[model samples]
Target: MTQKRISKELQECLTTPPAGIKVNLVDEGNIHNWNIVMDGPADSPYVGGKFQLLLVLPTEYPFKPPKINFKTRIYHPNVTFDEHGSMCIGILKSDSWKPSSRIPNVLTAIQQLLLEPVPDDAVEQGAAQKFKEDRKAFDKEARDMTKKYAK
Candidate 1:
């Protein structure tokens, strides 16, 4: 059941991909993991950067939300700056996630997060505080990080 659903979702994502986002299977035999490449939004600090990400669907997917981590570093309040690059997005939250949610929706939400970081629900508290208190510095740091890490 999990494989069938993953295959179906994978096909749909490949056929009708979201803007600035590209997704591919990590391994031909593994439908559970995906490699994603996303172009940063023009209006954000991450503009002109290409970010890589990993999305992993659990064996009990549809019952549990998929996990996404940035393979590239980003200096946003919602995304961690270290190796983990963990992100905080509303839809991916266990309580907020729904079985109907798709990969495209998740990618789109990520793009929106880059455009406007949700400081209140941030994963990196210092980055969030900087974002709220000093918008310019936050943008500069984010852009610098995007240039350094995000190719």
Candidate 2:
């Protein structure tokens, strides 16, 4: 059931992706794991940067939310270091996730997060502090890191 839904979603995303985003399966056999490439929103601080994300679906999806993490290193308040890449988005959490939410929505939310970070609930403490204190420096570092890894 989970596989079927994921397969359909994957097909749809591949056929018609939203602007500035692309999705592909990480492995041929694993429909549960996906590789996402998102272009930074236009005119934003992150503009012209490409970002990579990993999406892993649970065995019981819909009923359970998929896990999303950054595969490309990004300096962001909501993403942690150590390459663990845990995201700090409300929709990814159990408390906020809804059964009706789909992969497209998740991807959209992640892109939105890049444009507007939620510093109060941070997974990367240093990035969050920098973002709060020095917006310009944070933007520069984020843009540099995005160019380095997302290219």
Task: Report the C-alpha lDDT of model 1 over 50-129, residue by residue, as the tens digit.
Answer: 99999999998988999999999999898888999899888999999999888888999999999989999888999999
Q: Which regions in candidate 2 have their CA more than 4 angstroms from the true location?
A: none
List the pairs of residues colliding in candidate 2: none
Cα deviation of 33, candidate 2, in Å: 0.7
On TM-score, the candidate that comes out on top is 1
lDDT of 2 at 111: 84
Compared with the true structure, what per-residue lDDT tens digits does model 2 show for residues 1-151? 8778888888989999878899988998989999999898875567888878889999999789999988777788988865778888889889889988998998889889988999999989999999999999998898887777767
Worst 10 residues of 2 by lDDT: 42-51
Give the poorly placed runs of model 1, Cα more than 4 Å off. Answer: none
Worst 10 residues of 1 by lDDT: 99-108
What's the lDDT for candidate 2? 0.86
Model 2 Cα shift for residue 102 (angstroms): 0.4
Estimate TM-scores for all models. Answer: 0.96, 0.93
Whole-model Cα lDDT per candidate? 0.92, 0.86
